[model samples]
Target: MTDVSVYTDPQAAVPTAPLIETRKLTRHFRVGRGLSPKMLHAVDDVDITIDRQEIVALAGESGSGKSTIARLLAGVYTPTSGEIYFQGRAVSSMRSRRDQLAYRGDVPMVFQDPFSSLNPAFRVSHGILRSLKLHQPELTRTQRNEEAERVIEAVGLAPASDLMYRYPYELSGGQRQRIGFAQALAHKPKLILADEPVSMLDVSIRIGLLNLMAELRRSAGVSFLYITHDIASARYVADRLLIMYAGHIVESGPTEAVLANPKHPYTDLLLGAVPDPRAPLSVAVEGDTGEPPKVIDPTPGCRFRWRCPLVVDECHHVTPTLRLLGDGHEAACHVAEPDAGMHATKP
Candidate 1:
């Protein structure tokens, strides 16, 4: 596992306060607008922390409320309950437009679809210039252009001045995605909420972007909340891995430890689901094919109980909170031992 302890070091010069944190962070949507409206619990009571320059991957299935958490942190969606803290300051306290703009500058969001995120009508420079103008008003037009060129080049886009003049339609998917990163960089952000940033790119190109993220963290001291469903990619770039399911963070720990010895039944199932390329082409893969449940206005029991192969009697009645198993690894499961999934059997 390459001694993941270095990444988990408690003496890594972490700030007195986390760069970003969510305390019991939750968000619910009103699905039905009729006389009897029902709340769709998209995200429920998730607590996470991102230290300066740390890469934390939030991995799960597609509808696992991963993007909702990103949106909440990006200020695109208001949290239904709970609070978000940036640099130890409550996000709710930033009520004024100036405060909100400042916060957004410090924490920008790079979305999933590179094509849709940028304006087709405008050149690649539009988004970057807009961000710089809003975040760095002191910069003149010429300085903004220079800064934009520097950012474009920084993201590995060659001939930055030439590329900046081209429209979004002129660029490849990877190039457009680099532009997205450049846009975020224009704000000089401290952290970025990256929602499936590399999922849309070619398998070959994905590594480049992941490497870029690591480089950004190494050089610029930028932090990231990397949201994705690909466990392999998460394992590759993230120092910490957080497994989310049914609006709950089911498992979290240092990436290698959690993946090497997953404690929760759900986490075990998730790892089992990852396709093994080394296996024989003729060999059939086996595991439960059940899908994650859609959480609505619900009861108190564990949400994963229905899909869990190792569901216990306690899981049917009591919602399990994250308990420290050992070495900072935690899971929300009633029947799982600290070392339960080290040699987990396929269900």
Candidate 2:
């Protein structure tokens, strides 16, 4: 089942301010065996907003462009087209050294693998202190040491004194993640673009880190743009959810609402397919069961049409722009179930 058009009384505009906004944000890469390679649309005309102190989960499987968006937001890969604004300031035109440094300082990224992210040769203290030295270089040596101790302890690295001497290999995966958090929190970033931050950790420890993140959000006002394919994790930490498919966002809204009633066919497939003990698991939606198509100057239409179970003829001929429903909810699907509540609204 598919659904669209999610407004009954059509609510008012949200009062909150968007911490980050990307208008027609796009990224393309040349990939081919020959010169003049064909462009692969890593991310296409995607528009989404993140609010201050809110966790926006960008959920999707691999090649779904979720991680690409996270990397783009983190200032790793420059966008081939479009602009990103942080607190109403445009980042595209600003290339000054000061601007770049400030951008990196304010927005830090946490990768999936904590072990690789940290230097194997250096002590755990070295990995966390490097960020402080670069960003807060004005601090005295004594002050920097104090800062490291403070952040590590705050991250619940109890007896933080003992952990500093350990190397990456010495610490457990959960401890490594805490050190990563310590690094990010040292700067007190406005936004942390976490690309599957806890995907590699043992299931038992994943919840602990997620809980720490949630507590950080509540206490420190740190906004998170967490990227993951796990809906259960998304439900655990996210206030909002953005479901992406084939370099495009199909639907997004308040987490509980979108999870309870996913609007797009792809989202429905995602929701129904997730492991749920509360509801009986159903057969996964089947169509063209594989990756997305070639994206060089792609023909204008819904990109999910190929695999979408309810894809209609209109989907191929017309590109559906995301339409706002109410209270920060939006989707870009063409054919939604008539009982939109079952697919787009909260229970």
Candidate 3:
């Protein structure tokens, strides 16, 4: 595999509004219909953004609302409240079929499992061709075929002519995953919501895929919302990192800065969990064994207080909001002080 390191064009101009932005986005699910129906807060009051040609990693453990956010951005699930703005336009305001189709084409999704994302019965080019047909209906049959081959080759699958005719089961896992990217690329999207695209592959294969993403970003000017539980991979490919805990964004900042000085206890716990094979192991941090709370009709308070070692009185009654902690860093915690690093204590 080529070097996994990504090159950033430092001189690239920033856009007026972000490529995509969410304002207090929230999605809830009603479970067990009865006299009293309960609301499961899948995502709650989350605000996030992805700039043009930028890669933002939403990193967290399973059930942290990472995938839910990706789905919301992809328009698979409607938000119970809040608004999604793409290029400063509210998504909900797009009433026409043309506008809806345009939005879907501009914001394609790549699911976690490449196998399920592709149809085993059809040839590998099926998805790419279909996406082209939807987004570029003006193109003729020959043009669609050419476009499909172009995207397949763009994802590093050389000799797209031969590869496009092959079945999904015939290709290796990495190749199949690349085809998934090809499908997204075929849409000519501005931002791709990649939901753990590399988690199913081997470590060596994962690097190649990561490099492909970097190459695509460099060559195509496409922004990505990369969702994953793997922080190390996120650090390798993402310019910015947002850490979510129990359906809320706990911390967010530049990837290196967030890892170097995690202000939130949950962020610290996630970092501590990643084992370093080179270093000798020591006792685990206190509060590492606790489980995340189930978000069924949750009470109003800081969600992490149950497992937080630095819990304070304010954390139990009042929910914490993300406060700026300098250097573009923000954390949603009552006890974490600005510039205090992760060693913050309760008064």
Candidate 4:
């Protein structure tokens, strides 16, 4: 078995090195059937890091390239440019089959769709047991079944024997989702890239899954890159937050701090849309007015400029770089003041 030293101690002092880091990671797809094909900037020059035992929530609306980032991290889609590093080792440079397999074993993904992620032909235990076979080939059949049952119970599926034989079709949406968590847990991975794992489940069940993930992080010393559009849930579970818009991370900071005082206009707009019980019923909701800009052949400026209420001439000319606003807080907006105040600008 590969020694996963990175996830050894949960209570130990935080390590300076990042477990997973991406430097200017970008992925582009060529579309249109012509000599001059357009380029879709699915992920554009984004930098992110996930430290050991940390839950970083990547929140963005649909088509904001959140899932693409998750896929890139999971080694599903190769990046067109830039780099991904796992435990300080460059992922692109891992040539040996052993090293590649070790990396995959250490970085399992919990996909969004519980219904389709598992095959209908096989029982729940078969899926997890198959993973155990590949990762732990030395284990005997009895040991493997015991480990499978333990993992199924760990994911909150009680009476593991009953669930072990059931097909994907027989389980409820929540049960299938728990089985998804169990499959990822079976690998004993250091990092889990959960891409909207609870969006399809009932609202009541979402908290249960999130709690299970938190428990895994605490007990097993696992790191998570949680991708979702739901800000409320993100705030509840994440320690830090990254708000993405039009393929760019516009704002990032401590979850509570960012929620209480957002620096970027886009972030403010998102917070405004969230229902507040204290606010009057007649309170007008401010939202993004226009459609998102075309990622294909994108203009050389801030992507949110077209829909921004505080648009200015400078926004149309120069792309705003992500700059530090305060302690650990960053924003990529020209008019965002350091203290979360809006800078007046000409339209």
Candidate 5:
């Protein structure tokens, strides 16, 4: 039961097409004090396709490598091995820094921390002007300023003129986030990678920001790759949701379908862990945070076996593949048949 409801837009005018694709992508890092340090398989083998004008959320617990995947797709880090394709052509094959720059203008990222990305010393106008000059330098001084102010207003930084000289510290969290968004949208980028864009904002402001993003998608056809740890919020904003665990997508498909009829044990645990108003403090997640499992050089079986309650001896011997079960829904589990019944009751 692939929940395709969140993605089906009757208003979209163009035939659906994939804008970005990654094949067998992988990234590994070596971390530790010893000269011969332990390797961290931050991003294991992953294949993904993002369609034009569609927002697909990458949701998982922190450190599941969702951020790594975001960085990889945005060209921030080249994949250790595998191919990255944008609009059918390969990224690594592209020659010349100018061509790369052109491609980047079409694909920009909005970071999680507004402070980390925005300089504290510069005024809001100065920040936007710098990006405009870098990406659209042909504009005259007046043209660039006008364009900057127009975009500022478009992203809902009200009294856009009034905020022109304000520094990062002068603005509220929500207002600062709006500026980051305005800068990203200034390029008129076709694809936007938002890494937890709303996590730092207040809950009320989060909805307003989300509503703005939704409007942008429908009006401008800007596809979003939203990375976040909030499942319910993902359901609200994403057309499709990819659930990642231990650097692997254990389950993925439409948000409603995957959330309602979760097939993987990890998915169930994740949803159960969501903060529910009905349960309040009783909604627990994995007992305690404790130390996460060390998956580098892990055995070939289920990486989640350390936490999966339904795990059996066979689960530790053979790794599960991301097999398509029905419709568009897919899962990497031994018992993921579409018609199979739930193995046990809720925790």
Candidate 6:
């Protein structure tokens, strides 16, 4: 394992204030019949902060509330409780239309499906031109078109003139995704919510996109919230990692430290699942059986207790909060407390 301190330097010269922050952000939904509707806790008391130019990766299984958090940050969904602060202003307090539009312009999203994001009716340049018109309305048509071509080229699409006329169906998956990045860059956004942007692309093309994003962060100083299940890719791009489970962030810290010495059982499980060529064929790593616990009207104890291998009596009664481990690392597990010897191990 490479030393994280030498490789990932997210903390170097970081600003004191965060670019975006959440204070006990909670979002719930009502499901089932009207007689007794269940409250689904999609995000429960998630407090996170992202500094400028920092790449923070949110990793978890599907339906673990990663996308929900992204949506909340992108202003796609309203939170039931708590607040989302961007540049020290409350997102919910932006009552005026102008304020909302300004907020949207500052924070753009790059969705998972590149094909669906780009409209087939419009050319590749049309999407970026539209964003330019919306955000940089003062610019003339000629200026907007030039800006579009520049952004397109910046995302690695060469010969912008030729590619601008191509439709979504005319471009390959990688090209279409590049167009998505170009569109996001049109607004010169301060932060981007990348929700599994590389998951749908081919393995060969994924690295290129990751490198593109990393380059963008370096050149543009844009903060990113990269949501994905692929821990390996997260480690490659992200400076820090936040592990989500059952709608809660169970563990968070510097990416390599968490990977090298996972404090939470769920984090350990996720790392154990990663493929290792050196391991024997007969030696298999297995996760907990049974479906994940229902989020609707969840019990008081730890959300992961039902599936946790280190479940103890206290885990069933006490809802563990994120406690500091060391050097900004935190975990929400009673058994895997900071002082406990819960080092990385196969699950």
TM-score of each: 0.93, 0.88, 0.93, 0.93, 0.90, 0.93
Candidate 2, residues 215-257, lDDT tens digits: the string is 7777667889999999999999999999988788888899988
Clashes of 4: 0
Q: Arrange candidates, best lDDT first.
A: 3, 1, 6, 4, 5, 2
lDDT of 2: 0.79
Total clashing pairs for each candidate? 0, 6, 0, 0, 0, 0
Writing each residue's lDDT as its tens digit, candidate 6 over 46-134 gives: 99999888999999999899999999999999999999988777888889998888778778999999889998998889989988898
Model 4 Cα lDDT, one tens digit per residue, 38-109: 989999989998888899999988999999999998889999999998877789988888777777878889
Q: Whole-model Cα lDDT per candidate?
A: 0.87, 0.79, 0.87, 0.85, 0.80, 0.86
Residue ranges of candidate 4 with Cα displaced over 4 Å: 1-16, 277-284, 341-347
Query: Over the stretch 1-347, how does candidate 1's per-residue lDDT look in tens digits?
Result: 01111122232223588988899999999887879999999999999999888999999998889999999999999998999988788999999999889889888999999989999999999999999999999999999999899888878897887999999999999999989998998888889889999999999999999988888887667889999999999999999999999899999999999999898877887888888899877776555555457598878888887777677688878989999997989999887687556434546
lDDT of 5 at 38: 76
Q: Specify the poorest-scoring 10-residue window by lDDT in model 4.
A: 1-10
Which of 2 and 6 is the better model by TM-score? 6
Q: TM-score of predicted model 4?
A: 0.93
- How big is the positional error of residue 4 in model 3, measured in Å on the Cα after superposition? 19
Residue range with the least summed lDDT across 10 consecutive positions in model 6: 1-10
Model 1 ranges off by over 4 Å: 1-15, 289-291, 340-347
Model 5 lDDT tens row, 229-327:
988789998999999998888888888888888888788877767777877685565522323655676668888877666767888799888988767
| Candidate 2, backbone clash total | 6
RMSD of each: 4.8, 8.0, 4.0, 3.8, 5.4, 5.3
1 versus 4: better lDDT goes to: 1
